[model samples]
Target: MSTHTSPAAGPDAPAQPQGGRHAAGPGRAGRDGGLGGVARRVSLGRPGDPRWARPGLWGVLALAAVLYVWALGRNGHANEYYAAAILSGTRSWKAFFFGALDAGSFITVDKPPLALWVMGLPARIFGFGTWSMLLPQAAAGVAAVAVLHSAVRRAMPGGYGHAAALVAALAMTLTPITVAINRDNNPDTLLVLLLVLAAWFCQEAVRTGRMRALVVSAVLVGLAFNTKMLQAYLVLPAFAPLYLVMAPGTSLRRLGHLLAAGAALVVSSAWWMVIVDLWPASDRPYVGGSTDNSVRDLVIGYNGLGRIFGSGGGRGGGGMGFGGEAGAWRLFNDIMAGQISWLLPFAVIALVAGLALTARGPLRDTRIALLLWGGWLAVHYVVFSFSSGTFHPYYSTAMAPAVAALTGLGGVLGWRAYRRSRAWSWVLPAGIAVTGAWAFTVLRRSTDFVPWLAWTVAAITVTAVAGLLLARLGPRLRLRVAAVALAAGLAAGLAGPAAYALTPLGSAVNGTNPTAGPAGSGGFGGMRGGFPGGAREGGPEGDGGPPGGTPGQNSQQGTTGDAVPGARYGLPADGVRGGGPDGAMDQQMIEYLRRNLDGATWLVAVSGAQGASSVILSTGLPVIAMGGFTGSDPAMTVDRLDGLVSSGRLRYVMTGGGQGGPDGGGSQVTEWVRANCAAVKASEYGGSTDRSLYRCG
Candidate 1:
């Protein structure tokens, strides 16, 4: 895919003669923009314009989408977290993590609501299906690549803008990790796209010094928080030095910019934090090895400290930092290599070379910008390494934009250096020959002669060579066509290996994949959405297991598709028949509850004094559990649970399923009834046609 292309300038192009003289300089030609100015520079008097040029970007997007869909041909199932959330929210309706009022499934991990809202909507509409969830991530991929193209166009001039963007889009279009995540259900794709937006916003902020760009940076950061957590916080500093070192003179005014950025962060992440903090510890559920950590634990420990140090990064639903296993260290290294092995060493060399070449001109700024990106990545990883932090391989995506952009920058400069001297003739072509070697290696892998996840390095190497060849083509031929074709070929090559190696969407990950979840649901800690029942699976509160008792443990360990008996209001318990009268009543309650919740909305509910929460049951709402049952009844924790639920801190209740729950505790079922036992139809299990359901009021 290597090519050196410099397109024929449009007649009116600033680089061309209005009559004879070249209009702009090399480092700054494409940097300026105003209506009249753009018209002159882009040659509105000639061939390209928004009408035609846009199609190229759009065409790339379309191609990316198609590749994404193709990835889906091999994509069948998704991460457990997504499935569990959908199942729990749609089916059991637990709003809290461990609020096992009904019967919970998810545990340990803490995440923002944005991702769940995504899955929940499609589930509510088409009813928990695949394509809907997968498609959104695909959209994220398109956006990321599109933005990458735009960013590349801005950074490097000449018609190289279009070439860089096309190459970037093409490269991303075919990345195995990107394709897999886009086709599968996980939040990393979102994180990657957000980071992409963030980096561009940073670039824009530096170039324009616009307050809006600063705010947008904040907003994107916040979105990253919503998508994942601090995992994306890595964006801020990634470009800090870029602005400081590259832009220079950015002091007094920068304070205001920092304030705006900080404000955006506070505005975005606080709502969930406040509510999460208010929930009772006992009310939570832990699954996928995730232990029921408190809201504080979730926000600070699991989410905050855990990411930096090690709160949850373990076999259990540990976050990025809970003490990891010996093999986990390898995972961190693997994730890094998996993402940008082609660039790590090359970036280092480029950084050194870029710095050495900069004689304090614009090259200095560009070089600093490039180096800061790599620095940010190195620092983030080093800091993370020192702490007992949890590191998901996908977290590597945060580093992608920085690494990729720099890698591209490095390639451009390397090509330029080679062109400057005939003495290095063998070096450039020789490197490409080696790339062709890798290309063949990838081709062999893609052929299924060996493994899946054919390292993107293979294709990336090919793209490097393509880039070199494209650069050699000069400013005459339409290298754009060949550039795009090469990009597609590169993507196609990478896709083959991943396609063959990746398991079906819902199928267990291939045995060789370290990041793949364990063979069964319970042990599948590394799996994305590593929860039970698919999204909305029986949450602690929703799982209508033995009352008073906890959600039934999966006695049948290490299994997928072992349908846990689901509770219901209207729908018959998945497989159970004739649930007991109480279970039937629970089902009725569930039916009532479903009427209230908006698929993509977030809400907090509180029980009233009379404990008359028929509103909760009758609505099938996503209620955070709270204390209730009034009239001075000493046993009414509903008031407390109600407050918690109202604050979005609690989730569900148990009733009739047991006694040993409240002061007047009955069996686990009765206790379940008193706590969650709304008068609805719900069942957990049955004997042939004779099943049982529970009711609570």
Candidate 2:
């Protein structure tokens, strides 16, 4: 086995295969000259096959790069919320550390800055183009695929290990949500990458009984915590147990190792939160999504428990359901199923079967693989399914790696078990049939999303089921028919997501909330407009909300003065810049803000990042995103704005359709501004009323 071979390979395994067709009796080399010897060695991943492994791994990564990086600029600073943050971070170290939404450090984005820090490097070097800001995510996606392959290769048996690794990598790559996320600037790409790396290191630590590897694994998880806050710890239940069960150590020593690793996690993850909290509220940007202006509140209340219990206004935006219900079926619901659950049924089956089959075995490698990936899937599954907060379909991107790994490893192991015992033959066929049926059910949810997928899935399902049944013809026919069945099953699972992924989502999806599926155009064959941020008019930004509402709109309940008060999020545009009521203001507005507002600490204090981020992007001025995302956080109070205005640090204010806008759900700050500040006539800025700017005197 390789030096890094996982515990699954067994400690006594040899570096190379002991024998195969290439054994060729006695001392004869597998490649001993002539066509005869070559013919014997000519097999897929055969023992003597040296040329394919490295090349195949590279090939998978190359394909991932093509999918994730090629034409990626079309996304154009995808998720402008984060894009704007990156832009600010590149200009100032303070903004970079705080994850400030605007260059002026008025308010930070809701999450921690680790993702932005990684993205900021390229932006700092390459000057913050769409390419620079998004490349890190694409590269992370490719690395994730490579690392997943490495983990699988080390864990699975040799001959078929290569195939399993390739398939898992491809499955993850083709997952539409994963592709959508990586191609865009979403932080889940970084989160997913770090988790997979942690998994790999944990696998190594178990195999080698190395304390260093185990410590590295814990550190990565802590780092992941920094990346996405508590969401990164979702895998801890499985991760901790795996080390305890598999690591080679005595009772006391193992306890010490686990305790020490726990300390590392606390130190690594908490240090950042500690520093931010300790920095003094007045010294740093207001914690964006927190109600109390505390980073800990942002984490524990908003990003943390709010994600599960559905409290806290902005971060917890109710349910992901189109009808605004965050029910138990959310994971399998129409809107989310197509995005990430296409292979969920198959993965669940494989996990159950793999665990059951290996349950009695001596702490073997396959058992360990199942525990890790299955644990990952189970934990995320429960949280995503039951969580009542602002869970988007794209959030399921974190679950993609676990599902893909389980599918590959589980399918391969089940197939081997089926061949060895007649009783297990039922497992493979059952998994295929169930997965196909589930896929059909999921695809049918929105036929308009993919018109032809219904029939295509029907055909694949019938064929795969038929092929699995046909394998009973005889031993010789069994292997051939099963191979066809497996291939058909794989194809059946990938078909729908692949179609969805092949279409470009375009630039309008640059928001805090974006969904991906087999859908229609903004950049052709993709959905347009996202909610609650400044987006181009008539683009994807204007799709879901009330007509002529905020550029980055939301569909929360009880907001006064909207045509569709709770009808989804932002409205989609007609692809015409500056066309109708829903159209965002032209660049002239930005130029006006830039030309004026001299020497003010903040050029303008706007309701949310949606209204302010665009202005900041256009002028590089300090536009305060008063409330963090969706204009819902009470980051600023009336007194805070009064002080800014009194001190002459804030000269202009824009209000309307944000938190505490005319709706009365936002802070008293907007009302106070309205009571004191003079409204700048809309005509002065070309009759653009989406944002009603005022001169604070």
- lDDT by residue (1-697, candidate 1, tens digit) is 2322323542112222222223335633444455755655444322232222345666767877875664342232244334344434545545433322212322322466566666555655554434544566767778898788777656654443444455455555544445445655677778788778877787777766776776787788787786676666766666655555444345767766767777987777565655554655454432111223344444555456655655443321234422233242432342333332333444455455545444344443355446655665676555454555555444444555555555456545444455454444234444334434544443442243234334554555556556646655675553454355344444433444234223223332221112321122112223333311222222212212211111121211112333322322111344211113232323343333344333322122222111122222223233321221111112234454445445543333433211111322343323444455343223322132322222222
Q: What is the TM-score (0 to 1) of candidate 2? A: 0.83
Q: How many residue pairs clash in each candidate?
A: 159, 24
Return the top candidate by TM-score. 2
TM-score of each: 0.59, 0.83
lDDT of 2 by residue, 89-202 (tens): 877889999899977787899888999999888777756666666778889999999899889867765545666677788889888778777877778999999999999988
lDDT of 2 at 631: 63
Pairing residues by index, what is the TM-score of model 1? 0.59
lDDT score for candidate 2 against the true structure? 0.69
RMSD of each: 11.3, 8.1
lDDT of each: 0.44, 0.69
